[model samples]
Target chain A: MHNKTVAELSKGLAAGSFSSVELTQHFLTRIAQQDPALNSFITVCNDEALADAKAADAKIASGSASPWTGIPFAHKDIFCTQGVKTSCGSKMLDNFIPPYDSTVTRNFKQQGAVCLGKTNMDEFAMGSSNESSYYGRVVNPWGENLVPGGSSGGSAAAVAARLTPAATATDTGGSIRQPAALCGVTGLKPTYGRVSRYGMIAFASSLDQGGPIARTAEDAAMMLNVMASYDDKDSTCIERDVPDYTSTLNNSIEGLNIGLPKEFFSDHLNANMQQQVENAVKELEKLGANIKEITLPHTELSVPAYYVIAPAECSANLSRFDGVRYGHRCADPKDLEDLYCRSRTEGFGDEVKRRIMVGAYALSAGYYDAYYRKAQQVRRLIKNDFTAAFNDVDLIVGPTSPTPAFGFNSKGDDPVKMYLEDIFTISTNLAGLPGMSIPGGMIDNLPVGLQLIGNYFDEARLLNVSHQFQQATDWHTKTPKGFE
Target chain B: MSIKREDAENIARLAKLQISDEQLEKITGDLSNILSLVDQLKAANTQDIEPMAHPMDAVQRLRPDHITETDNREAFQKIAPATEEGLYLVPKVIE
Candidate 1:
């Protein structure tokens, strides 16, 4: 039951093979026994999950159950869950419980999905590895020593471990895809504004977008149907019609032109990872997709531009968390300035503070033209590069990260090396295009992701392409040794 | 432009974060490294292009200015670190 994909679970629920409460309990018990070792979850809502499951059972009995009714899923701690702690993997919000539900959680609740718990993440979605989580790092289920790439590491690990069929995750830069790649799961980041960001904590407002992480593209599509919706509450939410994402999963890709970025295949990529991606492309070719060599000239510019833009946006967004209104406050304050500084410094983790300080510096008066403004201009060229490539190809394909998951502390000393982990995944965010990471193949016993980048608002095509690849390959179906 | 130690301190103060002396040294180095990486952007020429704020060049959508929400201050304030009768408590800005 735990190993079933979301599609399989939907069929079982509709057939009355198991009650929602029973299914929910199966996952809850697995979490209790397994999560102590993984540390994938921040807070498990035991009583709430059971109650929701029971209600779902009643709803099923009444014959009003949706496909997602009673499906057990995890939410990344980035989303606000009413009455439950939405920590954003930060001590700042360690004890902060939202009085209201985030739009994403509300959408899930409306579908009657059972909430297993909130999964861990890098604090405020800042880091490439989950080590920055105040709750401690999440171990990759594949190998305990290796990291579950982050800041959506917990969601990817939870789905890979089959603790939950699928989980909601966000990508600010590579948060969702990089982790999904390392954990051997399927994750998607819809075009910016494709999903409402009303209650999802902001990292870089321009780059942050929420999507789903699941065992299969089919499962991800099912979850996306619920997660993507326009909310008037989120001013940036695109006022576009939400299609049935699962409806397009079986679409034919024959004669589809796929672009392979030349820069992504340079000497920078690991040899094993390059071979795995090459084989993945060969699989796509066998599936009747045409591969074209393309160029995103500004590819190398992404890392630097992202560092400036993301931090600049973060410094502004995080200013709302002053010691006064909500979140952690100082023990005592001699003055307002003391209150503000102490609370923030004590509340936030190192990675979060480092980003804030860098952001502040970038946006500072004298540095604005050189740093913030210059990065934005380069950001335009990056977007233009994508715009040109898409004219010749239906979609772009590349390795999600240069390599598979590394040891927990491999790049601990250097911040630049850590930032480069998202090198292959960041440009999609810069261009506000829809992108996805599907389990491509294994390298050194760890999974490498084949990233699919589609033109703006082309998620249907991306899901269709991913689903076709998944059908021809068993990469997405593989599970870690112990978890299996 | 590499960030100096004093630059990191000034940035921390502007960002409203208190950095201990030890954290200050480490942060300075990290920030400098990150900035050096970001300095790669200067290599790209952008003489005529406008700074792109969003990918889609989307203009902010306007809605009717009338009240679209009911008051939920009590529920919201319930989770505040310090609160008084229907208001958030903060260190006094004035004497």
Candidate 2:
């Protein structure tokens, strides 16, 4: 039961093969027993899960159950869960029990999905590795010593360990895809404005988009059916109709044009990892994809531009935590200024502070045009590159990260080194395009992700291609050693 | 493009974060490294490129000017660090 995908679990629930309570209990017990080492979950709601599962059982009995009715999954802590602690992996939010549910959480609840718990993440979704989480680093299920690429590391790791059949995750410059790649799961970041961001704690507003992480593309498609919606609450959420993402999963990809950017295949990618991505492409080719070499000339500038734009946006978004509100507040403040400074200082972790400081500096009066504005212009160039490439190809394919997951603290000392970890994944965010990471192959016992970048709001096509690829390959089915 | 100690201090102050003397040097170094990395943007010919604020160039949506939310002040203030009689308590801002 624990090893089953969400699709399989849903079928079992509908067939009455097992009760939602039994299935939910199985996952809750697995999390209790297995999560200590992986540290993937911040809060496991055993009681709440059982209650939700019981309700789902009733719904199933009534013959009014949706496909996700009894499905058990985890939500990344960044999404606000009413009455439950939604920490966003920060001590600042450690005590925050949202009085209301985020849009994403509400959608899941509406579907009658049993949420197992909230998974851990980088503080405010800032870091590339999960080490920045105040709850402590999440270990990769693939190898305990290797870092699960983050800030959605916990979500990816949870799905990889089969602690949950699926998990909700957000990506702002590779948070979802990188971790999914590292953990050997399928993760998708829908086009900007496709998924509502109303209750998602903002990292970089323009770049952040929520999606699903699951064992397979088919499972991810099921989760996205519930996640993608038009919400008036989130103004940025476009009014476009949400398609049934699973409908196109079996669509043939014959004559599909896939672009492989020359820049992505250069020295930035590890030779062996490149080979893995190429192998995945070859599989897609056999499925009738037409491969073509393309160029996104501004690829080298993406990381630099992202470093500026994301930090700048984050600095402003994070200012809401001023010690007077619901989050952590410092003691013994002599005045308002001290209260503000001390609370924020005590609340945020190092990476969070570094980004805030960088953002503040970039957006500062004298430097605004030089850094912030310059980065925005560079962002347009990056977007334009994608616009031009999409004209020639149906999708762009590459390695999700330059390399697979590294050991904890391997690049921690140097901020620039860590920034480069998302070199392959950031441009999609900059361009507001949909992108996904599917397990391509294993390198040195760790997983590498094959990235797919689609034209804006072309998620159905991305899911279709990814599902077709998974049907031909077994990479997404391979589980980590001890976990299996 | 290197961020000096004074720049780091000023940035922290603006961001309302307190960095102690012990942490300032390393913070400055890290900021400097980051600044230099972002300096790569200067090479791009962005002179004619329009700056993009949102990915889809989405304009903020406007709704009817009417109250949609039920008052939940009591529920909200329950989590505030300092609150009294439905008001958020804060350190003195004026004499």
Candidate 3:
């Protein structure tokens, strides 16, 4: 199972070549030694992981096993695990252990996959950079001075640095893809409602969806197989059947029509990013794929509409954490107002509170129709633009982010500058389509990512294309200079 | 449309956040920049546009309103600041 994909690992486990405890121990050693400087993990459940691994071994011995049995994976901290600390990267939840497992976590555990630990994230999934975590900023495992893109930085960094085979991550806006791009890993955000969010901490709920991150698309496909399910617990969960994602890996991309949106190549895009993505497309062309320029005219308006809509939803969702129920509370309060003011002020980071205020203002009594309603209308137009593009192309390709990973203090003192990093990624969420980021090319040695977007419920096709690319190039297999 | 300091603070209060006097000034400037960008969305003609909240207009696939979910109120409430008689406790405002 050492050099094998998750499919191979599962086959070997079923065939009794390697026990679950042995597999879990190898990863634990790597994480213990490597995660200290990377700060990828906030909590490593060493004892619990071993116990789960032993149980998985027993299940396999009793002839009760599945493809996910004995697979070791880490979960993002935002998902609540029963009896495990579920801090969504805030001091408010730093000590808060949950009594219930999130639907995603429970699904993996039911399949007998051992949870290694909770990975770090941007506080409440609000930051474009990993620096917003309450624990401390996570550094890109590629370079010491570079920042790992966020708010799923921990999951990306852990996978890229070989601390874990794969990890579970959520995207609201570009939390999953941006970090996956910056840290040089593979991540997919399934179509909205494709995964259950029952135990996930609320963050821009309308845009949030969870998927997998790993070194290669094949590993991601296997994890996606287990992660996707129709859950009755989450009202938004899709009723569609989950497909065998790995079944399509051998499908050829010959004559596959790929759309390159003109708006993605606007002057606002950094020249270097555009060049690297072009190179990646050229490589795909060599593999028999046909690339075509398509128009997604409403792309430019996505950022503005997203900022307004996302924050507006955030304001309503975050109202639950009033310090009276289940989060941090002020030391002393003379009234309920004082209690709320002090608790929220002390509880949230700058960016989260900034969004809450923006959301509240947009949704306020007078501005609701003007700002919030208008934003929703534009969101529909954005989704329509994508629908129009799919009529001509099987997948849409572009730079996952505008540029490569930035320095530790890059984009500092300017929030808008940081928000632009998610420009290309946000529209996919707006359109409610599946999106994946694959290791594309390098800019000044830091990895850049190429994004592939599929029509709704087209995750299997997206995975097939990414797997073909990984098989052709050694980019996904190459680790950073120092990390290895 | 640069935001005024008073307007910024007013919004802050409405949002229930405490911004210090000095923080209000910086926040005012920041809000101005963001709003200037956000204002661009209003230029599009969307009179006939329908507001979309989801991909489909189908009825929500809700679980039967039965007690499929248990209230581990005692377990969950262990993390709350105050709980009494199975209800979350808070300051009384209508004394």
Candidate 4:
């Protein structure tokens, strides 16, 4: 169960190799025994998962099963799951049970997929490393002393450890791709609004998008099929057609034009990372891709622009978490102001509060033009660079993150250094293009990820290209020593 | 663009989040680090460029205000720390 892909598991279930109940039970026992050390799961949905697994078994028995009918997966704790604890790694929402389910989770449930549990994340999806989570940091399964890239660290770690076949993840400024890069798993951030963000807790509205984390490109593609849909409930969801992602897994990439952004290979990138990404590019070239050099002139401005836009939006979206409505409230406050203050002071962590302050200042009356508005304008130019580049090329390639997984306390007490980790990934989010991270060769035994960015709604091509690369390399299949 | 303790407190007050002096000191340091990056964006040239709010041109599609959901309020509130008279209990206001 641990090493099998979603396609293999689904085939086994349909062919009477084993029932969904057995698979679910196997994963549950493994999670119960192993998750304590990794701290990957914040809440395990045992009862709900078992019930769904039994239903999936019935579907297989009746010859009416979906492709992923019995496969078990987990979600980042940020998604609102009905009757399940959906704490977004916050002390405030520690006991908050949402009345409704997030569109992503609901879609999974509708597919008869078994739920494993809720994985941990940085508090309110705020940090680059997972340390800001109130539930505690998620350690890398490969090396417990190293950090699992976050705020989607738990999802990445869970998939890397083979605790689940795949996990649902959200990326705002590299949350999904960065962690997957560090963990050596395949993760994708579909075009913004490709997957509805209806009941998913807001981080930064414009930048927040959901996608998948799995062991291989094929598994990610299958999960993408289940997750991609237009939900009227999500006001921002695009009303467009979703392609059959799995069908394109074997699509030929004979003439695919792959662009290498020259700015990404500069001296600032670590020597080891440059080597790994360059080697991965060579492999793609061997697969018959038409490789060429391209320049994104606005690459250097992404970090600064993102800090302004994301925090400003975060400041606004997070305002709803006042003590009055839902989540945490302080005890015995004298007035409204006191209640709001005490609740927030108690609720948010160090990283969340830092963003709120920065966001509030940027969105404030006097500073709005200098910070927020200017960032938005530059953001447009950044997107334009990609738009123009795509007209000349089919896809772009870069290092997913600047470096591999660093030590647990590597960037200690320095927020700016941590922010630089997403430099390659933030621009894709800014441009609203589909992006994926395929496992490149390791750097000093730590996994590195090669990033692929495609034209808008071209997730099928991105998956096809990644699938071809995975077929040629064993990096995606190489699991950590102890976990296997 | 460096944030000070007073600046953090003022922003906290504006955002309606309460904070203590000790918390303000640490938040000031962290915000200063973040804002230094924001300061770079503020320096960029955007004299006549229009700000892009969203990447898509699709208008917001709202679900009908009708209840397409279950009446799970009772089940939802079951986990709340305090409740009274079929509503969530919170710190009282208005003398």
Candidate 5:
């Protein structure tokens, strides 16, 4: 039961092989057994899950079931779940119980999908490694000592560990793709505004997009079918119609033009990691993709630009946690300033604070033009690079991270070294394009993710290509030894 | 691009985060390192390029001003630390 993908589980539920309550319990038991070691979940809603499962069971019996009915999944703590704690992996939100559901949560509830719990993440979706999580660092299920690449690390790790069939995750800057790569799973970051962001905690509004992390690309497509929707509540959510993502998963890739950015294969990427991505490309080529080397000249500038831009926006967005309305508040305060300062200082973790300070500095009086505006201009250059590349290619492919997951704390002290972990995937977010990371291969016993970047609103094609790649290879099917 | 301790302190203040003197030193160093990394953006020729504040070029969609929300003040304020008579309580701002 734990080994089945969401698609398989949905079929099993439709056939009544096992009741939704039984399926939900099976995953809850696995999480209870396995999550202690991985630290993947912050809140496991056993009671709520059982109740939802019972309701789903009735829906399935009545034959009024959507594909997601009776299926169990996890939500990254960033999404607000009514009456459940949506911590966002920070002390700031640890006490927050949203009065209403996020759009993503509401959609899943409407589909009657049973949610197991909220997965851990880097505090406020701010770090590359899950270590920044106030709950605790989530261990990569692949290896005990290796860090699970993050912000969405717990979601990726949980899916890798089979605690849930699929989990909802968001990517600000490689949060979904990098962690999915490290944990040896499939994850997607949809085009900006492709999914509604209302009630999904804000990090970097421009770069943040919610998607799915799952064991297979087909499963990810199924999850996207439910996750992608337009809502007036989220002003940034595109008003365009969303296609059924799963409908295109089996589409042929014959004569598909795939671009490999020359800069992505440079010395910056590990040699062995490059080989794995090249192998995935070869497999794609066998599936009828025509591989060509293209240039995204501004690739190297993405990380620098992202640092300035993300923190700048975050400083403004995070200002809402001032202790006056909600979230962590100090015991006593002398004045309004004291309440604001102490509450925020205590609520946020070091990485969160560091970003806030950097953001404040970038948007400061004299530095605004030099830092904030300059980074935005560079962002345009980065987006233009993708626009030009798409003229000759159907999609771009590259290694998701420079390397596989590194040892815990390896790059912790050096912020820049940590930032570069997202070097390859950050540009996609900058361009507001859809990107998917599928298990490419293993390097040094850890998984390597091959990233697929689609042109704006081309998630259907990306899902199709990823599904075809999975069919040609067993990389996506391999599970960690202990979990299996 | 290096950040001074005073600058870091000032930034923390502006951000409304109280940083102790001990953490300030380390934070200042980290900020300097991050700044140096972003400083590379200076080399890029972005002349005449408009800053992209949002990914999409869409303008803000304005709707007719009308009440769309139900009263949920009690439910929302339930999570607040201190509330009295439907008003959020905070530190004294006026004498």
Candidate 6:
């Protein structure tokens, strides 16, 4: 039962082989036993999960169940869950219990999916490693010493360990893909505005987009169907109809042109990891896809531009967390200024403060033209590069991360070295394109991810490409030693 | 591109975060390192390029001005640190 994909689980529920209560209990028990080692979950809603599961059982009995009805899935702590603590992996909101559901949570509820709990993440979605989380770092299921790539690390780790069949996650710069690469799971980030950001906490508004991390591309597509929708509450949610992503998973890829950026395989990438990705490409070619060498000329500038733009937006978004409203407040204050300063300093973690300070500096009086405006200009060039490349290629293929998961604490002190972990996945977010990370193979007993970047709103094609490759390879099926 | 201790202090003040002397020294070094890394953006030529604030050129969607939300202040204020008589309590801002 634990090994089944989401489709299989839904089938079982429909067949009366097991009730939703039984399935939810199975996962809850596994989490109780296995999660002590991984620390992937921030809060477990035991009573709420059982109640939702019981409700799902009622829906199943009524013969009106959707594919997701009675399915148990985890939500990253970033999404606000009504009456449950949505911590965002930060102490600032540890005591917060959202009075209302975020649009994402509301959608899952409408479809009758059971919420298992909120998963841990980096503080405010700021770091590539989960070490910055106030709840403590999440350990990689493959090796306890290695860091789970973040700020979606907990969701990726849980899916890989089979704690849940699937979980909701977000990508800002490479939050979803990088973690999925390290944990050996399937993850996707849709085009910006394709999903609503109404209730999810903001990190960088333009770069942040919500998607899913699951065991297979088909499973991810199923989750995406429920997650993507337009909401008036979120002004940026695109007013476009979403197609059924699963409808095209079996589409033929014969003569499909895939661009391989030379820059993606350069010295920044590890030699052995390169071999694994190349092997994955070979498998795709055998499935009748055509591979071509291409160039995204301004690839190196993405990191620098992202650093400036993300922080500048974050600084403005986070200003609402003053001592007066909802969130942590200082114990004693000398005045209003002290109240604001002390509360924020006490509430946020080091990484959050570092970003806030950097953001403030970037948008400061004298530095605006040199840093913020210049980064935006460079961003245009990066987007243009993708626009030019997509004219000839149906999709872009590359390694998701330069290397497999690094050991925990390896890059903690050096922020710049840590930023480089996202070198491959950032440009897609900058250009507001859809991207997915599928398991390629293993290197040094760790997993490597093959990334697929599609033209705007071309998620169906991306899912089809991923599903086809998954059929020819078994990388996504491999599980960690102890967890399996 | 090196950030000074005083610069970090000023940034912290502007960002509304309190910093200790110890935090000031460490933050200065970290800020300097990050800024230096971002300084690589100077290599790109953008004399005639247009700046992109959003990924897509989206304009703010405006609806007819009307009452769209029912007041939920009571439910929202339940999580406030200090509230009194349906109003958020804050340090004195008036004389």
Task: Please name the candidate that would achieve the greatest DockQ relative to the true structure.
Answer: 2
True contacts kept of 6: 0.90
Give one digit per residue, the lDDT tens place, for model 3 in A242-272.
Answer: 9999999989999999999999888877888
Which ranges of candidate 1 are over 4 A from the true structure?
A: none
lDDT of 5 by residue, A384-453 (tens): 9998999999999999999898999898588889999889999999989999999999987789899999
- Candidates' interface RMSDs, in order? 1.0, 0.9, 1.4, 2.0, 0.9, 0.9
Q: Model 1: what is its DockQ?
A: 0.87
Q: Each prediction's TM-score against the native?
A: 0.99, 0.99, 0.97, 0.97, 0.99, 0.99
- Candidate 2 accuracy as TM-score: 0.99
Candidate 2 falls in which docking quality class? Answer: high
On the 0 to 100 scale, the lDDT of residue A421 in model 3 is: 81
Across A1-484, the per-residue lDDT of candidate 2 in tens digits comes to 9888888899999999999999999999999999999999999999999999999999999999999998899999999999999999999998999999989999999999999999999999998899999999999998889999999999999999989999999999999999999999999999999999999999999899999999999999999999999999998999999999999999999999999999999998878998999999999999999999999999999999999999999999999999897999999899998999999999999999999999999998988999999999999999999999989999999999988889987885888998999999999999999999999999987888999999999999999999999999999999898787
Per-residue alpha-carbon lDDT of candidate 5 for residues B1-95, written as tens digits (9 for 90 to 100) = 89799998899889998889888889899999999999999999999999997777777888789999999999999999999999999877889
RMSD of 2: 0.8
lDDT of 4 by residue, A280-305 (tens): 99999999999999999888899999
Native-interface RMSD of candidate 5: 0.9
Q: Against the native chain B, what TM-score does each candidate's chain B reach?
A: 0.91, 0.92, 0.80, 0.74, 0.93, 0.92
Question: Which residue pairs in model 6 clash with each other?
Answer: none
lDDT of 4 at A226: 93
lDDT of 3 at A239: 90
Which stretch of 10 consecutive residues in model 2 chain A shows the poorest summed lDDT?
A407-416
